[model samples]
Target: MPHIKNALIRYRIIDKALGNTYNPYPSKLDLRHACEMELYGDTNGKHISDSTIEKDLFAMRQEMDAPIKYSKAHKGYYYDNPDFTINEKPLSEDDLTSIQFALSTLSQFKETEMFQNFGFALNKIIDRVNVDSDARKSDADIDQMIQFEKSTAAKGNEFLQPLLSAIQHQYIAYFMYESFVTQVKKQRKVTPLLLKEYNNRWYLICFDSVKEKVITYALDRISDLEIIEQVGEKPSDFKADLFFRHSIGITASAEARPEKIIFSAGNIAAKYINSQPFHESQKIVLDTLEHTKFELFALISEELIRELLSYGGDIIVQEPNSLKDELVKRIKQMKTNYNI
Candidate 1:
């Protein structure tokens, strides 16, 4: 259960002294000096304090559950049981497995820019896990057995920390945002509330005081951000769950409402959709070898249309004439654009 390797080394040194029959009763100074010699060698390096020795003994007894006991006559530490050794208690198999699993899970984010500041701490834990497990299970080893999605140098990830800080500190943030449709940039002042990530893209979901509504803004299109001023109280009316209740991707249109939209997908697209659903509200109405039908209670946003279109001939819109007509109109526009 040693977090750092030095603790393990100190435990071994104490174990050796405690179990040494000839050395019998090594006092506190004897233990500390022995540890310094073993760790720092004959270099006369900074001596470890008596408290350090005391803590090491305490950690051994408490953390490792070592049978350590003090003899009043000997005036030193010794083990109640003579046969116990530090080597016999590395880490339980279950413990090692859990630590390895945690390291593997963290390996997914260790490479991302968002995790760079924590790289040293993460790497130290990884190294400790490797040593404790007695297996050099690097990222490559985990990759061979199980694959994880590759990390990207995703845009707007840099803003995550600052936006989260602003939210925590109750501050208003000012930034210039570029509109995708209008192709125009405009200054926006908003109360920072939340940072959302979807499909590796970052988004700022905040209350727009000027517009008197909650809105989602893409981080990539945002620039020149400044934490403007402190706000007395955040808009209590804005509930994240309610705001994104009918969301599709990052755009939760103010005018849109959640409605049931049913669609059928061919074999290939059905396989993909079954693996990764379109939305949380997506439900399979029917499943078969040829085509599978699905129903989604979600907003009919541009992202929904765009992703559905990505499936091309593999999917058919089966209900809600409004969505079908919109798709038809888009298809016609696409054909006209292609001069087909």
Candidate 2:
């Protein structure tokens, strides 16, 4: 497995070098240099030999049946078919079995017209695998072995394709949006920047031209989306990761700064939180038989408070008096609702 993995890595490195038209022509020495730099750079300057690269090229050409050829005129290696990639090649029986099983599982979407094209594409791949009737039976057995949770159809999923198109083409999108605070629908024109999926819901993070700030809109709340011919202005300094750095979920307050939030969880909830953290910044501050204290940096938002509330009595906010006060207020409200 290690040998196969190493060979695959080398194959990818060579393939990329061969396909790169921008770089200088990749000679044998150049290929060795690239392999050494990528594969063995951190290992005390371990070197890759010319013989190994030659064998790799030979394996790709003969063993893998890849359309690889050397050009003495260009002094480099190139694929006879420019579009060819190693990933597109045929798979072994085991690989085919796994792929068939995965495809069959995904075939559940075949019932939906929105996913018809995706299902067709999966079927084409299965056909290309050339599985027999026995393999088909094996796929059925695989399906019995594995199962997915039942998922209801989400609203506005049909708009996913057009929104994706708008993001790709850099076109300004005009959509009617309804906020939870108001019953009135308003027209919005924005440049869609990124699509974020959280808790089975999709949100479009766009630069709102009117607001002059980045805003997130739930896809389900958006309607009558129209792509304008005018090109959307891409923000010069906008990065999706940085934009959501301090946010727990879709809700973010520009004025709110990230704070070091300290909290304690009971034994059971501690194990759960340790396995599946709320954020990347989660760190264990203290751990004992009684409880586990954890710390993380994030902006205080309603989403964060709601998440904390979900744990109920299992979690307790330690520091940040503001968050603790909010939690107390919410719990008081809940108590009032129950009249307890």
Candidate 3:
């Protein structure tokens, strides 16, 4: 398999050798022999060298920060603390409790095809923790202590794993996509670049071959997804950070450029804004007793407009007369809706 996989297998063999207290104290040669037997099997007389075992020990201690130390008295390598294992660090009681709750929450997705891989990963973690001495609580006691957040049922979630795999392996993805504007499903192929989540919805950022530009497609609107056998071309010029840097949400306007946006919030709302900023580019332009004036460098998109409108009269757009005018128009439309 892969080099990393081989390294992990070697580490496991080394760890098992050291942790075996019943066996005679293992020397460097003993460890190397153990690794080779596990790797190539007993019939193959070929074995790893002393240097390779030394590097594995050094990496485990220095790179992995494992508490490994050679014991002169024992005449072998072992964990500085006998209770420790190289596979995973010992979990705190609180950490174990949190993991139990997280496992419980994730278990809800165990039956879904999309979460099959996730379920396997979760089971490994559960097995690892269950083996730990600190995790001794009974199942009923764990159930009593933790409650998961209620999740709403969502469609198209089953496509998440396949799309994620496509993005990771740089595969061209074929799917039937239905846009909100057209309401007509169309078969399309795109180079999957990145997966993003916004407001509880997942979106795939991909290079659309037909359009010859990058586009964002909501997962909820995608169906009949498949990964093409051919490898996709990764755009050298595209940077995800720069692509979404100016825009507030996924809907980015190709023609729009970043502009200075100044807005003022009431004292109460200012505290909230200061604590949870709207954007990384947000700055406190002016703070006075009357109100707090903040400025942001961003493209004015529909999401930004909606966010500003959500604040109602608590926030005022002070600059870019265009943004203020749009807010006014939307407010008027709201007034008409209410027949005010």
Candidate 4:
């Protein structure tokens, strides 16, 4: 297909010709030069004639809404307006840096509608930056980091889209799921409540109507998701945070109410809980120089235990003797199997 919109062409021109210095509003000569470079690329001695360049520039200025400006000093042209701009709320240097960081992180989402939406917002902000000097400190490394996230976001979207559709349409979604306990290829009918992206992979938080409860189905294990037209209403007052609040994963059923469970963490595990709180009700119960006890108000699930076990000897469940006994029983079963 013909490159009619020419986003790449426009982007390259802005990068090379303007070099962040030329006001997005620029003179005639600059436009001419940019157009030539964009169309032909470093033709050495063979350049577009000045008259043809002027004609092209005039046509572009008349037809397109590109920001172009004329400068008397250099006797050339520049962008009259930025391609896009953003009007952001008043921010400190740190705030601006944080926003820039967020934008960079969010850039990974560029190809998706979400990224494009944010880009539109960012463009308006960039246009409003009245910095006269084009030579802002070069940060290629930071740009690279931003670019990497954008690429990762594109790949992540492959799983997110369908789950999103299922949640929106209120369709019963059928997926081939691997049972975490049984390790069996089981087909399930679920009312997809929300799509959650924790760590890296996408997870479908859904009400398993057949199982008569909610469950978290890993997107990786899901295959052949056919949305059934027969719709069921999501439970009234169904808040995702409340549903998954106490549980570590999607294993918590309505059969269990919220409970406060205390766990002890030594060394790095304590540090982890301090920085990344488990839930809203997480609090430091006991603190010593070597160890810390945390009270987490959440429904204790098998997933929560697995997360605790993954911490090895660093974390110990201090409360809920039922859960502790279950862990102990598992340990004994393992020992018996090993004849130890």
Candidate 5:
């Protein structure tokens, strides 16, 4: 393998290629090719010399404080620090990885009708990245590198645009919605206020004109949406922070104040809770050898109850008899159901 000390590559050219996750190890030849591609955009441009690449690499280490490294196994150059920043804050190695991931995900939808709305903007962003990976690498190769819970046919994505437009224009929209509990379909007029995504599902937070209150409707439950000409004024009191202030998950009331919820967790559960908190207000209140106590200010909603119940024996509610009693009642129902 030809050493980087013997190669010559420009900052931006080498920056993108070195940082790219898809094209991890670029040999001296690869770095040279990258420099040629970036500088000329075609091979017909002036050929870059090996000494030029080597001198540039030396300057990057000494002048710019770049932690560039050579990987013998991959036979290419890379940055030791994933977060290393170049002059004027160019994309870091981590940033390049994220951008490549985003591009790969976007490519999946390139052939779909969904790109019709934001294709130009997406293309522009892609052009700006100008990162290189192996052209022969297939989507399956990336799929092996990283996996996401990508639901190809996740319902209600179709409603995102129209609902977004309604909110943007303050348009009074009408939709026939099916209630999950009642299974009753009814046409309702609402002023679309906000679009919220929770748990990989789309929901519309809107002012129900008939009910005269803010309501959340799952996009999957919505159909026959019609944007009306009659505009509605956005509620002055409807602040996003104040609206979801009390709630743990999607269930929130703007008028409600958050209550102090304290819970004691087992050793295993405490670590998990500490790392991935249920809410932004979560804090360590008390810690002991037996268990750790955590506190959060949130509404005692069904989502909170379900979260607590999911933990099973790993956690115990410390205060607020209201929540404890509800859990007890739920446990009793489960016991009766299972004949425990």
Candidate 6:
């Protein structure tokens, strides 16, 4: 049985050689040599013999209408059939949905126009996936299907080169930044470490030289930026991935450190949290019969508060009096608004 299986696999390899040909398929002995080389590389200087390959070819001739015929010059068999074609069947419904979701996600990058080719390639995949005769739409309709609009007219192309240069060289770029909080006008010089785009907004993760600490400045708030020759050094152990792993958005400040948070979650909320972790430091504390207790280690920024509020009654922050106080205040304000 094993020998027959190996022979079948070898025949499949021969079919592959034929499918890849422009005119005539490779000779039988040549095909076997190619397959042997591919299947078993020069691990111990061992290779399949020519006679064994010829016997395999002879055995294949008795099985099916293999387009192969004998050739004297090549001293082996060659393809005689000219009408051979490899037809790629259409993808399943699951494949189409998966392709659509991928294309939708890719549409987010069209803001920079760098991923336009991906959009085109996604269209081809969508066309192949959707084979229903009555289907009217094509994957090219992704442009209309997805609406990834950036709040600010982000000039990803015009500013990307200079910004990347500033980040890589650690040079300071002068930007006219308008603070959304205080609406303050400040000309600041910062040592760039990373650039992050979140929720359709671009942010620069850098150490403010004057402040001597890390700060996140929104790119949309930047008016005019020019890279300066002056450069500064980042922390020796500073890793962007680790730094932002516990953060939500770019609100993590220099003073922000990992803090332990205990919370109770409903079954639905627990599943949601498990699907996408609240923080890298998050862990399931108690998985009981009714509810779940979760411990989170993350930067307790305004983003965290907002996320908790969005979940409403589904989650309850157990410890950290500061967070509890804030949540209570917000809840009280909500109560006062409704006067209930």
Per-candidate TM-scores read 0.57, 0.58, 0.57, 0.51, 0.60, 0.56
* Residue-level lDDT for 204 in candidate 4: 80
Q: Across residues 94-180, which tens digit of lDDT does each residue of candidate 5 receive?
A: 455566666768967876787865676677667545422332233234434544344444566656766787887899998899998
- Write one digit per residue (lDDT tens) for candidate 6, span 1-340: 4355455556656655665433244765557666685567432325566675666667656655566677687565565765542223233343345546655666677556676645765555455444331243554554454444325545432345567778778888776678888998788777788888776677788887777788888776776676798777576767887778778756775556767889998988889988887676788989987789999888788888898888899999988888999999999999999998
lDDT of each: 0.79, 0.79, 0.77, 0.63, 0.76, 0.68
TM-score of 3: 0.57
Please identify which of the two predictions, 3 or 5, would achieve the higher TM-score against the true structure.
5
Error of 4 at 330 (Å): 3.4
Question: Which window of 10 residues has the lowest lDDT sum in candidate 3?
Answer: 133-142
Which one wins by TM-score: 3 or 6? Answer: 3
How much RMSD separates candidate 4 from the native structure? 15.9
Q: Give the higher-lDDT candidate: 1 or 6.
A: 1
Candidate 2, residues 1-340: lDDT per residue as tens digits? 4456566778877877776654436888888887776777632335667898899999889867788887899898888888777766645554555556656767777768777746756676656454343556565553354433445546666567567878888889999999899878999999998888776688998889999887889998988888887789777778876878888888764556999999999999999989988788999989999999999999888889998999999999988999999999989999999998
lDDT for 31 in candidate 3 is 86
- How well is each residue in 1-340 modelled by candidate 1, as lDDT tens digits? 3345566668887987787664667889888887897777642537678888888999888888898988899898888888888767746565566566667788889879888767877887777666544444432444355433455756665567568878888798988999999999999988887788777788998878778677789998888888866872467666665777777887775566788999999978898998888798888899898899999899888889999999999999987889899999999999999999
Can you rank all candidates by TM-score, best first? Answer: 5, 2, 3, 1, 6, 4
How does model 5 score by TM-score? 0.60
Per-residue accuracy of model 4 over 1-340 as CA lDDT, tens digit each: 1232233234334433543341334454555556665567643426555665555545445544345566677675566554432122233344345445545555577668656745765665544331311223442334333322232332223346556767878887777877778888988888899887655567787888887766777786766667777686577767876666666655556567877788889967899878977766889978998999899778777777777777878888867898798778877887899999
Candidate number of the best TM-score: 5
- Position 323, candidate 3: lDDT: 94
